[model samples]
Target chain A: MVSATPTRERVLAILDTVKDPEIPVISVVELGVVRDVECGPDGVTVVITPTYSGCPAMKAMEDDIIAALDAEGIGGARVRTVFAPAWTTDWIPDGAREKLRAWGIAPPGAAHDDPPVQLRRAGRVRCPFCGAGDTTLRSEFGSTACKATHYCNSCAQPFEEFKAI
Target chain B: MSNRFFEYLLRLGDDRLVLGHRLSEWCGHGPILEEDIAMANIALDLIGQANLLLLKAASVENAGRDADALAYLRDAREYRNALIAELPRGDFAFTIARQFLFSAWALRQWEALASCRDADLAGIAARAVKESRYHVRHSAEWLVRLGDGTEESHARAQDALDELWRYTGELFLTDAIERELAHEGLAADPSAFRSAWQKDVDDVVARATLRLPAVEHWQQGGRTGLHTEHLGRMLAEMQVLPRTYPGARW
Candidate 1:
C-alpha cells in the first residue's frame, strides 16, 4: 500500500489490523486464517481458510479483509477461500496464545493427525483466568465452532477453550 | 454438467441441508444448555458444507440459479436427501440416535471423498471429514451416555435406535448414479463403507448396552427421490423464507 504496488509485508500489516470478528484480540494472520497474500499484476488476492467448516464469521472476515485493503487505496481486492491444508489450532502462534490467555480464552492444545472416530474427548484445559488445571468440560462446543466451553472447579469461573481441530 | 452428476450433488447437498434444518430446530429446545449450543453448532457446520457443495452444483449446471436458489427454490418432492435424514426430529434420544448413525456413515463417506478426482469436491470433503470426526465423537459419546445411564434413559435410547434402524440401509445403496460416478473416480463407492460403518456403530452400541433391531425390510428409495411424508413438511418450513421473499437478504 505504501508503494502503490502493495508489497506482501504491507498487505500483512493491514491484515494484522483486521482482527477476527468473533475473537477480536487475535488477528486473522495470528489465527492462521489468512493463508497467503498474493500481489499479482491483476491485483491483490487474499487467500484465507475457515477455522471451522460452517463458521459464520467467515463472511464478516472476508468483508473485513477486503475493506482493510481498500482503506489503504488498494481497491478491487479478491478474497479466495481454500481448504487443502485444513485450518487447525496448530496455526495459532505462541504470542497470540498469550493474547488469548490474557483475554480469558484458553488457547488450543496440539491437534491430532491420526485416524478419526475416537470416543473419549482427550486433553485437559486449564482455566485461562486462574490457570487452574481442575477444569471440567461444560460443553464440547462453545459460543463458536472453534471453541468449547469449560468450567474451572478451582475458581468456579466459566471459560472457553479454542478447540483442537 | 451431466444430469447424473447434478442429481448426485443434490443427493449429497440435500442430506446436509435437511438434516441441518432438523438440528436447527433443536436450537432452543435442547434438553441441556450445552446440547442446545452443540446442536446449533453442528447445524451451522452442516448448512455451511451444504452451501459450498450446492454452490458447486449450481456452477456445474450452468444455470442462472445459485446455491440459494437450489436450496430455497426446490420443493419436497424434488429433494434428494436420504429418508433417514428427513424423519421427524423425535425425542432427544431420537436426535442423538440419528446423529450417531448418520455421522458414522458420513465419516467414512467423507473420508473416501477426501481424495475424489474433482478438486472442488475433494476440497469440500477434506474439510468436512475433519468436522465429521467431531460430529461422530459427540453423538457417539451421547449415545453411550444415554443408553447406559439409567432405566429411563436406557429404554428411550434403545427404543429410538430400534425405530430408526430400518432407514440406515438406504445410505449404503449403490445405484446407477453412484456406480457411474464411482467408476469415473469422481464419487466414493457407497457400498464400500458399509462394513466399516457397521463395526463403528456396533462398538458404540455394545458399550451403550443398546441393542440393534433385528434386520427387517431395508427402506431404500430416498436416492430416487422417494421420501417419507416428513420431508414435505420440513421443506415447506425451510423453503418458506426464500419462497416468500424471493431475493430478500439480511
Candidate 2:
C-alpha cells in the first residue's frame, strides 16, 4: 500500500522528479512552465505552459510529468495547457540557473525589466565550458529550439547556450 | 458572442495553413541546405500557429468540427485564405516578398489581437505574436540582404514586390464580419493597422533600396470564401489523406 501524502504535497513531490531531457540537473518544476497544479478526488491536473511551442522536449516533458504523478498513485491526471499570461524567462527558478551552468550549459540571461520600443541588442552569454563571458554567437538557432550555438574564443569550444525562449 | 470573431480567426488560420503547405512542398528541394532547414522551421511555426488559431476558433464557434476537421477536411471554396498566401512562392525573392509582407502585416495585427475581449483568442494571440515578431524580423533581415545583394538579386526582389503588391490590400480591408467583431472588441480593427503596417514595410523597403509597389485596384473577396486557382491544388494535396481516411489518427 502506498502512503497517503497530502494531494498538493504529493503533486509537488512528483513534479520535483520531472527532469529536463537535455540537461538532467533541472526538473520541469525548476524550468517554471508548470504554471498551476491542481489535485482533487478525481485526479491531478498539471497545467503546463511550454517555454516555446516548437520546443521538442515538450512531449518528453509531458510523459515525464504523467509518469511521475502515476508513480505516486496519482493516476488519471489530466495535463492541460494554459497559454494566458504567456511564459517568460522570469519564471525559471534561481537554483535551476546554477544547475544549468554546472551541467556545462550556459543559462539564459536575465529578462529585460522594461519593454523597449526598439529591438534590444541580443544578450551576452558566458561560456559554460570555461566560464568566459567573451563567447561569440555562431548561430541564433542551435540543435534545439531553446538553444543557440556559440563558440567560446577563450575555451576554443563550440557549445550550446540555452537561449531565453 | 459574435460569430464574426470565429470567422476572422478561421480566415487567419486558413491563410497560415495554405501558405505553410506551399512552403512545405520544398522540404527536400530547397535551394540550399540552410534555406531548406529555415523554410522547414518557418513552415512548422506557421502550421503550429494554424492549429492554435483554428482550435480556438472552433471552441468559440461551438462547432462540432474541431481544428483537425477544419484543417484537413475543408473544401477549397470553403477556405477563406487571402490571395497572397495562395500565390506560388515563385522564387526565393517571391517567397521572401510574401514572407515580408505577410509577416509585417501579421505582427501589426497580432499586436492588436493580444488585447481581444475573448480570453482564448487573446491567449493564442499573445503566444503567436512572439512567433510572428520573430518571423517578421527574420524576413526583414533577409529582405535587406537579398534586395541589396547583387544586381540580379536586387532586380528579382524588386520584381517580386511588383508581382505581389496587389494582394497586400486584402489583408487590411474589413468585411461585415470583421466590422462586427471589431465592435465587440473580439477582433482587431484591421483598418487601424494599415498605417502601422505601411510604415513598417516602408522602413524595410527603404533599407533594402526597393521601391514600394503601388496598391492599384486591390483585389478583394478572399474573406468571403473566394480564392485563386492555386488554393484548389493546395487543398487537394493537404486534404487527401484526411478525406480518404476519415477519423484517421497518427
Per-model TM-score (chain A alone)? 0.94, 0.87
Model 1 per-residue lDDT tens digits across residues B54-114: 9888988887989999998887778899999989999999999999999999989998998
lDDT of model number 1 = 0.89
List residue ranges in candidate 1 displaced over 4 A.
Answer: A1-3
DockQ measured for candidate 2: 0.39
Best-matching candidate per DockQ? 1
Deviation of model 1 at A58, angstroms: 0.4
In order, the TM-score of chain B in each prediction is 0.98, 0.95
lDDT of each: 0.89, 0.79
Q: Write the per-residue lDDT of candidate 2 for residues A1-107, one digit (tens) a residue.
A: 25453467668777988898877888888888688888766667899886765566877898889888877677767789887887776777778888888887788
- Output the TM-score of candidate 2: 0.90
How far in Å is the alpha carbon of B224 misplaced in model 1? 1.2
Model 2, global lDDT: 0.79
lDDT of 1 by residue, A25-50 (tens): 99999999999999988899999988
